[model samples]
Target: MVQNIKTNLPGQGDEDRKIRERMAKIKHKILVISGKGGVGKSTFAANLAYAFVADGDSAGILDIDIHGPSQGRITGIEGLQMTINPDNSIKPIEKGGVRIVTMASLLQDSDQPVIWRGPLKMKAIKQFLGDIDWGELDWLVIDSPPGTGDEPLSAVQLLPEMDGSVIITQPQDLSLLDARKTVKFSQTIGVKVLGIVENMSGFICPHCGKRTDIFKSGGGKKAAEEMKVPFLGSIPIEPAIMESGEMGKPFVWMFPDAESSKIMKEIAGKIRAELEK
Candidate 1:
């Protein structure tokens, strides 16, 4: 059950303690971050959450992308919306048995925008952590906005016990360069780099069934090797992925037998193994 966020109620001190205790019971907290945008970080987070739930585990995806919230879309639950409970805490919407929280759900309308600065971002992150009752989740997948900016930093600081961070990047030189900066930022903050994910490594021509290096693949693997971080594998670019995202369905869920789905599941397995170790 989702708990409501209460305002100026009696016994507020005791209620706060209960919330903290509930949060402490969660097993794993993972942040999916990227230094550059358009690299499919939200998609990765959503599919990973779906895979976990599909396997009978309870998971949630929290979108800390204040300026560009899209996890609800990736999960195919866009426009459904969330509601604030009597306690004043916002309840996360559930889809396919996976609990999700995003700025999109909190918006007054689809066209609304979140225009805020550093302190505001920090406060929102804190509210999502301290006020909301997330219950006991096996995994909490947080999709952060691009770069090692205020949002990502705030999330890390709020959850001091985060298991690690997964960095997403493309197969382009420029993207790899920025991704390196993300790796360094994580290291500086004492967060482990679980691995690097290469999104859009190649594109498959529908008619030819041939793989083309649209963005010049292998850069991410090379970067991972040079940085001494594990390589989680690559996700090939497919037009179907975009179509699926638009239609409110993840490619992995829509076509679990497709090549892209296979890769995503493999990456999820690697993440699971790393967390276990």
Candidate 2:
């Protein structure tokens, strides 16, 4: 019965000084999970944070889902309500230039329904990872809530040095056995899978263009080559991505030269070339 899960850092409790200042200015903080729901994994963490800010970089999305946030309607920044600076922190919601953060922006009404549990969803994902304001960033996608509970175990216990994790699956076979239990629960907690995306996977038929496996294609790239990891591709089945997430805009920013937005910008350029190895 090992019980000691104390992690505090929402305002000034300096939890390891704000997680070592966000792993020293964030070169990476991926985390775009999945192991249950409809397996879009917050639409691949909002089109990989809009293809990592349209390739210029400096990104940050962080929805943490909180039992269904959907990155404010998939990055259109739905309702847009967060504003509390006077030193209380948390403002995150810029859009277009990235830096999002959401529980639907601390909701006033975005179809409210947090109905919290598990210590208030682990203190609102530890105040969206220590009181928001993820300033300098190359990437911070996040978007969890699809299994391995308590907001991806409070983002791996408030960033136990996170730098990788992306697992989404929808090629069926029961979503490849729940995406191999989210890749063995991120290798039993060390967290660094960085692969396995296969959302929707097939359905180009617009007037018979063929290719429609519907939900049986490749089985998340053969379950990422039998769970070794690193499949990171396939994302078909576009109906303008459900009309650009019902007009909140996000089929990779309204079909950036579609074909599922060029496979979500080549899956955000193979996750920036596997985070430069």
Per-model TM values vs. the true structure: 0.90, 0.37
Q: How many residue pairs in model 1 have overlapping backbones? A: 6
Which 10 residues in a row give candidate 2 its minimum summed lDDT?
A: 1-10
Model 2 misplaced regions, further than 4 Å? 1-30, 33-42, 46-74, 78-82, 85-87, 91-128, 133-157, 160-166, 169-189, 192-197, 208-216, 219-221, 228-235, 242-277
> lDDT per residue, candidate 1, 98-192, as tens digits?
78888887777867788899999987877777667687899899999988888877777666677889999999999889788888878777678
Please list all clashing residue pairs in model 2, or write none if there are none: none
Tens-place lDDT digits, model 2, residues 1-277: 1123324322345664775675578788888888888677877788788877877887888887776787787777788787888877777888778888878777787776878788888777876777776768888888887787778767777776677788988997988998998888887777779899888888888897988787779898898899888997888877778778767777777667876778788888887887786
Best by TM-score: 1
Q: Candidate 1, 10: how far from true, in Å?
A: 23
